[model samples]
Target chain A: MAKKRGRADIRERFGFAVKARREELGLTQEDLAAAARIHRTYLSDVERGTRNLSLVNVERLAAALDLSLAALFGRVDAGADGA
Target chain B: MAKKRGRADIRERFGFAVKARREELGLTQEDLAAAARIHRTYLSDVERGTRNLSLVNVERLAAALDLSLAALFGRVDAGADGA
Candidate 1:
């Protein structure tokens, strides 16, 4: 039986994906924050999985990261089962 | 050159994916709304692409539709270029 994943799990997975992508792109948090037009602290919060971001913000991040929405979520799904 | 997609486009595509999945399940708007614990009117707004929904609500809808988050987003990405 599969365990039900909660909101926190989802958020954390998303955060991990974002952080990984940022690192892969050699982007500092400030760089991504500026590109996404979000505050650095807000980006920090998102990276920490404390922010319950909406679709618009998610899109903003995806655009800043040069990723499609599916690609971004694909990372989240990849890490779902094990991490 | 790729045309930049606006937030409205993303929301609309996501909404279309949701609507399509809901229909594939032979579910009414009310049924999906109840299953996702959202108001029918809110679901209507979501279907219309007027609401910038949060991740929690998106997850709720995904769970209600029996789709993993990646699967749900795959639908959105599948329709991205053509529709």
Candidate 2:
């Protein structure tokens, strides 16, 4: 059996991606939430590495941002924060 | 600020999506990891809702499974376990 990685790590990585994209597009967390149909606070959590998003939410964000899922996860270099 | 959703929730939802896709395609977590160039343990964690994936790894898994990210996050009904 394979050992599992913790959810926190994944969430943090995802948050970083979202924050970068949000900045690259010149949107605040609030703006992203409005465009993505998600709550601004939730977007903030996602950006701060404190929250994980649902598939539905992910789709909403991606659609709102006009990005592919692959693009959402793109450019994982440390210090690549755009927002 | 909108309330941030917990990372556990996001990881769980993403895992559910991955498990459903893995089963739909008749592939094991190990198989998925291999195809995606990820670790079996990490894939297992992802499947079990225990792990959050890096964007790089998510892309690898998506490509390995031949699924779009939208498809990966599809159909979010409870009791829909495929794996």
Which lDDT tens digits does candidate 2 get at residues B1-83? 12233223556767887788789999977788888887888788887878656555664676677865445544322323332
Tens-place lDDT digits, model 1, residues A1-83: 14364423777788989999999999999999999999999999999988889988998898899987889998887877756
Q: Can you write out model 2's per-residue Cα lDDT over A1-83, one digit (the tens) per residue? A: 12133323556667777777778889878888998888888888877777655555665676677765546645322323332
Instruction: Compute each candidate's TM-score over C-alphas.
Output: 0.88, 0.48
> Which residues of candidate 2, in runs, are more than 4 Å off?
A1-83, B1-8, B75-83
Task: Rate residue B43 of model 2 by lDDT.
Answer: 81
* Alpha carbon lDDT of each predicted model: 0.86, 0.63
Task: Give the TM-score of candidate 2 (chain A).
Answer: 0.74
- Per candidate, the number of residue pairs that clash is 0, 4
Looking at candidate 1 chain A, the ten consecutive residues that score lowest on lDDT are A1-10
